[model samples]
Target chain A: MATVAVENYLKHVLLLSEGGEELVSMGDLAGALAVVPGTATAMVKALADEGLLEHQPRLGVRLTTRGRRIALNVLRKHRLVETFLVETLKMDWSKVHAEAEQLEHAVSDEVLDRLDALLGHPRQDPHGDPIPNRAGKIDSQVYATLATCATGRRLRIVRVTEQSEEFLRFAEDSGLRPGAELSVGERNLVSGLVTLTRTDGGKIALGVAAAGKILVEPRG
Target chain B: MATVAVENYLKHVLLLSEGGEELVSMGDLAGALAVVPGTATAMVKALADEGLLEHQPRLGVRLTTRGRRIALNVLRKHRLVETFLVETLKMDWSKVHAEAEQLEHAVSDEVLDRLDALLGHPRQDPHGDPIPNRAGKIDSQVYATLATCATGRRLRIVRVTEQSEEFLRFAEDSGLRPGAELSVGERNLVSGLVTLTRTDGGKIALGVAAAGKILVEPRG
Candidate 1:
């Protein structure tokens, strides 16, 4: 059985990879985990020895099948727990991430299965992140974001890809949650700003980089 | 911030003390924790240094007010989680103890409060153990067990005090869960056996030792 620390490292690596055939740089991994680069390197080397991941000297790291499986399982527990906290417990969505971080390592597969069933096997979490199925397969279909979607086209917010408490609170206040209907009003790349008009006709403006974190799709 | 091991140690100390003024012996503490006597002693000494507990040479260890507070909080978490598992999740009462062991350390105070409310602020867990309140106060009322209660009276089972899988399975099979109404049919002191007749006209036989674990109260 992998220790909690090992599971955390693997999950962070998989998150950094972001469903792509890319290596996660040591600096980025270290930053994500809030660990020093040297500490991340030592731990990465240890994980490589266990055959859970591959480490390339001075370049980056990638998960092996075994590591990915564990990471996906951890991720499944995390998102499902977040769903339970917000949907069942009526907790604030912006705060459930921290709670889920502790619970993911503690929940058993049996309890998780029950939670999944209770939640009706939700396709995605409250934040619009797709939940990985029991088989470790995740839905990675690409979607347009507020930054690049065509202006004046009806759109539905599909995801908010960041867990920043500040941003999520703002999104909640602005009625920008997943499944909320809106349209891009203006995109000024020169000024690095994007403005959205909600179906309620409420206008919200964001910097280009922050706007990119909100994934959306053209409404029917 | 107590580590998981530290919480486990303190909880065991409180448990073995049995709600009375008594010190926990190193031998019993080690046995409960499945640690060596030396290890238990070392840990007790360290806890004493931190003023979490008072360790008396060759006598035993006892929790100070600070230690007791933490232990009670952990106990509250454990019992509340067990209640949620069985009452909300519809899990087997006999199996929830192990699950709660993992969750008690992971659940935060905020989540615990919500769960407590969600479960309608339960005062007792599934097995009939009292849950500590947020203020660290616990209900420790004493009750008679089948082994010593007056025979030939209408009685209700109040608690099953052991978490032993085999014994709990037997209890479940016998329909002797908490709130079960039954009357003692006979007590053969020489044979060390106790016989019970349920209100539904079912008979169950148990050894005196097993009978003592089933606490009860007289039904009006």
Candidate 2:
């Protein structure tokens, strides 16, 4: 069984890979995990020896099939726990992520299954991140972001990929959340800003970087 | 911020002390924690230096006020998580203890408070173990066990202090759980056996050691 540190490392690798074959750089992995580069390198070598991942000298690391399975399971526990905290416990959505970080390592598969059933098997958590299924399968559908989607087209928020509490609070204050209906009124690439108009006739301006974190799909 | 090992050591010390001022023996602590006496001694010294506990050389270790507070909080987390597992998740009572053992170390106070409210501020967990309050207050009432209680007097099982899965399963099979009403029909100290009769007319026999684990109070 993986230790909490091992689980965190594997989960971050999967998140940084973004459902692609791209190798996660050591610096990026260290940064995501809040560890020094040397520590990440040593741990990556150990994981490679354990056959959880493949490490290329001077390049980066990528998850093996086994590694991805463990990572997905951890991610599933995290997102489902976050959902339970928000929906069942009525905890603040912005705070659930931090709570879930600790719980994800401790929850057993049996408890996860029960939590899944109690939450009616939600597909997405409060942060709009996908919850992996019992078999560790995650939804990999692509959606355009507010920064890139066509202006004047009605869109529904599908995900808010950022998890920082401050960012989530700001987004919540602006009524930017999954299933909210809106359209991009204008995109000013020169000024790196995006203007959005909610269906309720409210306007909000976001920097292009922040806008890119909010995924959307055309309203069906 | 105790690590998992530190938390376990302190929690076990508290349990072995049995809500008394008596010092917990190093041998007993070692046995409970599954570590060698030397290891227990070394760790106890470290904890003492940290002001979590006091170790009397060659005698025993005792929790300081700070140590007791931490231990009680961990116990509260454990029992409350167990309650949530059984009540909300509908998990098998026989299995929740082991699950809660892992979760107790990970759940934050905020999450625990929410769970306490969700479970309607339960005072006792599924096994009739008293949960400590947020302020570390615990009910430490004393009760007699079937091995020592007056024979032929109606008694209700108040707690089953044993946590082994096999014992719990056997107790469940025999309906010897907390809140079960029964009377000791006979006790043969010479043979180290106790025979019990349930209020519903079922009979079961247990060895004195096993009987001692099931605490009972006067039936209402």
Candidate 3:
């Protein structure tokens, strides 16, 4: 069994690569895990020795089939647990991410399946993140972010890519949660700010960097 | 924040001492934790240094007030998580103990409080084990085990103290779960065996040691 640290490393790698084929940079991996680069290198080498991932000295690491399977399983546990916390326990959605960080490592696959069933097999968590299925398959659909979507066209929020408490609270306060319909009111490329108008006539301004974390799709 | 190993050591010390004022012998602690005596001694010394427990030379160790408080909180998490699993998730009572073992160290106090409220402030878990409160007050009432309860007297199973999977499966299979009302039929001191009769006309026989693990009280 992998230690909790190893699981975190693999899970972060999966997230940082956006579950894509691109090679992750060592700096990005270290930053994502909030560890010094040297520590991250040491662990990456150990994981390589275990055949869970391949470590490219300069480019960084990528999960092998086995590693990706494990990472996906961990991700599945995480999202399902978050869903249970919010939907079943009636916990605050903004707080469930931090709670799920600790719980994902503890829940067994059996318990995860039961929770998934209890939640009626939810496809998305409280944060609108896709939950990997029992077989490790996840919805890989790409969507436009609020920062990049065209101005004046109605879009519904699809997901919030950021997990920070402050960001989530801001998004909630701005009525920018998943399924909320809104249109880009204005964009200032020089100033790197975007203005949004909600269907209810509420307006909110966001920096391009923060706006990029909110994924959206054209309203149907 | 105590590491998982440190938490386990402190929890085991409290359990071995039966939540009493007696010092827990190093041998029993080592055996219970499945570690060598030397490792137990080294850990006890470290924990004593940390002011979590007091260790006496060649005698044993006892939890300091702080250590006892932490242990009780961990126990509370364990029992409440077990209750949530069995009552809310509808998991099998026999399987929840192992699941709760992993979850106890992960759940936050905030989440625990919400779970406690969601379960309607359950006093006893599915196994009939008392759950410590938020303030660390546990129901410490002592009761006679099936091995010691008088023959021909009606008794209700109060708690199944053993958490081993095999023991729990056997208990469940034999209709000896918590709250089951029955009477002791016979006891053989020399043979180390006990016979019991359920109110529903079912008969079961258990070894004296196993019988002692099933606590009971006079039936109302």
Query: Per-residue lDDT of A70-150 in model 1, one digit per residue for the tens?
Result: 999999999999999999999999999999999999999999999999999998999999899999999998999899889
- What's the TM for model 2? 0.98
lDDT of 3 by residue, A92-201 (tens): 77889999999999999888988999999999998899999998999999999989999999999999998888889888888888989999999999999899999999
Docking class of 1: high
What are the Cα lDDT values of the candidates? Answer: 0.95, 0.94, 0.93
Candidate 2 residue pairs in backbone clash: none
Interface RMSD after interface superposition, each candidate: 0.5, 0.5, 0.7
Docking class of 2: high
DockQ of each: 0.85, 0.93, 0.86
Reference-based lDDT, residue A218, model 2: 98
Please provide TM-scores, in order, for all candidate models, with all chains considered together.
Answer: 0.97, 0.98, 0.98
lDDT of 2 by residue, B10-120 (tens): 999999999788999999999999999999999999999999999999889999999999999999999999999988988878899899889999999999999999999
